[model samples]
Target: MSETSSGKPGLTREQLADLSRHFDEDITFSRHIRAKVKEAVPGEATLYIDVQDFHLNGAGTLHGGVYASLIDNTMGLALISEVGVRTATIDLNVRFLGAVREGRVTCRAEVVHRTRRLATLEARVHDDLENLVALGSGTFRIFEKQGRPLV
Candidate 1:
């Protein structure tokens, strides 16, 4: 296996896509919302979502739910990269610090803590200009899979 910049095993695009596909059923809106998995590596992940009118709130800013969804997926991906399995978010807390009117929003997540049964992760959502729009943390239940194709 190749190594990522962080010295973790470089997950192939196929492996990443497989993990993303597993979550699609749970986060179906990700497709409609134009979310993309930008990067996935052990303990780290980045996701991007393009802001469209449909993603806007009544105030014409990005909806809080969109940020929450992005954070959940990003953090989940980070955990998945580390554990090579699916994870279900159990507790998620988000803080809206600012708002985005247009352009792509990026979410970067890191696995902060992990144990046999659960993982704790943190994420930050930023606008195209790299201004922090939201901050989030979540806990997820890890499920180890048997004979699942990873690549």
Candidate 2:
């Protein structure tokens, strides 16, 4: 799917809200690092993560684990949007390409495959300079619970 000039898909505000909620629940550090669900297509979603010192590593650089988490969350959110339900990560593979410093980062995820019980997604992390910092792929198992869903 593609984006419009506003950096969003052609979805209405309500639709965007619903899609954002699919991935917004697990994000508890909103006050420290702003997270925005920018878009959601049939099998894809984009998550924006603003950089802050709280996300830094011991070396004062952005943590690789943080990048991995962002990728995982974004990809899982994309799968949820596609499947219309909650899911749990079954497997994840991440590759770090560059360093992330003090700036905003964007994690883009696309669902590559979906089955009755599982979904696979690919994601990329880019720094504010538009440099690729990491790439990841993950699979999630769809769950049917009776309470609030995991994002």
Candidate 3:
């Protein structure tokens, strides 16, 4: 549960792609939510998810659950990309400020703090037109990995 330098370093672009594949294929819940990594590197990650009709809430806006899940996933992926390791979510806090009936939702997460024992991350989700739809922050327990998260 640490971000020790001895654990690992950020992944290469190729590794990020492979990780994305594993995310889509191995994480069953992800198949339902379907967020894709647009960028992943040291200190930062950006992810995107398109709003399908199913993603809407009863009132016809993007579901609040979608905001929470995507923000958490994107923030966690940023840590994984930075450390080239896997992490378990310790806590995730989100605030939903706006809504969109349809279009792409993007999240950008960045490492806020990291140490041998813990890492903190922050993220914001925006609609295609740049509306601030959500805000999220998380703490995760980092782990040293022998390979990809699925491996």
Q: Candidate 2 at 103: error in angstroms? A: 1.0
Which candidate should be chosen as best, given TM-score against the real structure? 3
Prediction 3 TM-score vs. true = 0.86
TM-score winner between candidates 2 and 3: 3
Candidate 2's displacement at residue 68, Å, is 1.4
Instruction: State the lDDT of candidate 2 residue by residue for 1-151, as single tens digits.
Output: 2343466433444544666774565557532355777776656788887778888888888888778778877887677655656678999999999987788889999988877888888999898889998999998998765224422
Worst 10 residues of 3 by lDDT: 1-10
In order, the Cα lDDT scores of the candidates are: 0.83, 0.74, 0.81
Structure candidate 2, residue pairs in collision: none
lDDT of 1 at 103: 96
How much lDDT does candidate 2 score? 0.74
Residue lDDT tens for model 3, 1-151:
2233545567766677777777656777666888877877667888889999989999999898989888888888788777776688899899989978989999999999999658999999999999898999999888766545632
What's model 3's overall lDDT?
0.81
lDDT of 1 by residue, 41-117 (tens): 67889999889999999999999999999998899888877777656899999999998999999999998888978
Residue 9 displacement in candidate 2 (angstroms): 15
Query: Higher TM-score: candidate 1 or 3?
Result: 3
